[model samples]
Target: MDIIEQAAKRLEELRRAGVEVAPEPQPSVGETARKVGAGSTAPADAQGVAQSRRVELDMNVLTAHGILTPDSVRSQLGDEMRVIKRPLLHNVSGKGAAPVKDANLIMVTSALPGEGKTFMAANLAISIAMELDHTVLLVDADVARPSLPEVFGFDEERGLLDVLTDPTLDLSQVLLRTNIEKLSVLPAGTPHPRATELLASEAMNHLLADMAQRYHDRIIIFDSPPLLVTTEARALAMHMGQVVLVVKAESTTHAEVRNAIAAIESCPVKMAVLNKTTGHVDGHGYGYGYGYGYGYAAKSSASAART
Candidate 1:
């Protein structure tokens, strides 16, 4: 089947599965031709034009995965995320304890794999996008192993690496605007043999600077690789003003946490998120908890108790 047919089939499947799929907006003929010429080969149909410019995020899938959606009901996860994002937002708005350069650029990472860093990243992005004044760009920077496609259910497309490697490519061409108003996503893009080198390259620095200044009200969240497992996360951290480290409760060792914090020591603001906690908070089972610290102070105060 062609692109439009495939999209129709997918929407049908989502509908069959009881997902409330929103009707896609139709773009003008001129707009469709512009997108088609830009790189998208989708047919000149409403669905095709919509698919080229926007993606319909499945609310049911988000809920099933324990992610906070725009229409998500009030719950412990929502409450916890609010608390976790408050300080980060403060820094972004220049209201924190200290002024943070490029405070809008935030990276979410972990010391090791399987620590729920990606999960935290997605939730944080979604939470931030719900804000009234700020918009969010969720970039999948884990080049070697991107998971945002799976998390958001959007097909993999050209993104961060592609822009850095190809001088001809523009960030606007690869950015996928989602149905969620205020949220857009940049996929990991075509993987390269020198992904690590590309992320640290001067080209990457230029792209980051452009992204940081492109929209004054925009916050860019990078779901980066594990700091201890790969060099990419550390390289990305060098450009990020704030970093959120995900620490699995009762699983991630204190030594590992310390090392992870040390890896991103160059970041102006560092925060720790205690994930997968087993306990009841406010009469609800806890899935996430957080601790805020900056610099070496996090190393001393960051601790998780066994349930």
Candidate 2:
């Protein structure tokens, strides 16, 4: 099937899901400033600030796993990510075409589990950090089934949920500063059964505004759950500037992908990635990998039929 047609099918799913793609006015700056600008670290000897801890990530382990090789390494993975992130960086810096609202906020998800969305999200954040002017904030948004702890070799730590649940909590308290200098992580904290509801709450919106505004130089990447398997991702998508749906090459049925895209139709910008293919394209052995196209075409008029 033509990959553009596959992307067309993905857009159709959003229509069926009753998602709106129209743009809304951006939130006022004052409404968002309070939640942002805490920086990567907390202040020392602040009053009543006894509970603050920093988490460290293992770069050597990640390198061994191929999740992170040096940016200068001449490899398919490095080159591919470079292509994948161009439009994203454009969206972030507003240097390409038009500026995207909340452009700094990005979510990586798939049609279902075991599709490497988490892997993609992690690596994407690290890859973005490789840039000279950008920093990365990786959030494990899959609260119910988070994988950041394992992916980054960090233990259970306080994170996004802790602040949402407790009004007394400050975001600076939970934000983790990694040894990577440019990369920081916000893990899914203590699981909550009402993860979906929490993500959709008013508090979440305000927090997202703050996150979007804070660290104007930072790109936020959320590793979300499979669209068809979890409600949490749908809620999280509302706060994001861009959505990247990872479709496992031959393994993911067209119907599955269509459904996944439909779930997040309301998102203003969405991209589809065809993952894990075996081929020798672009003069290299690009095996079992992915390449995506921005839903560069109109999103609302997309159409497709199930076989």
**Most lDDT-accurate candidate:** 1
- Report how far residue 185 has shifted in candidate 2, in Å: 0.4
TM-score of each: 0.76, 0.75
Per residue, candidate 1 scores C-alpha lDDT tens digits across 1-307 of: 4646645654554454344445778799999899667965543444333232578898776665656789877865677777888899999999988899999999999999887888788888999899888899999999898888877877888888776654444577678899888999999998777777677665566578778886557899999999998987888899898999989767899999999998998998898887765654235344443222111111111222211
lDDT, candidate 2, 167-244, per-residue tens:
545666787887776888888887766666666666676678878876667899999989998787888888888998
| Residue 257 displacement (Å), model 1 | 0.6
Q: Which residue ranges in model 2 land beyond 4 Å of their true spot?
A: 1-42, 45-53, 69-72, 281-284, 288-307
The global C-alpha lDDT for each of the candidates, from Candidate 1 onward, is 0.76, 0.70
Error of 1 at 304 (Å): 11
Q: Write out the backbone clash pairs for model 2.
A: 13-262, 14-262, 276-288, 276-289, 277-288, 277-289
The local distance difference test score of model 2 is 0.70
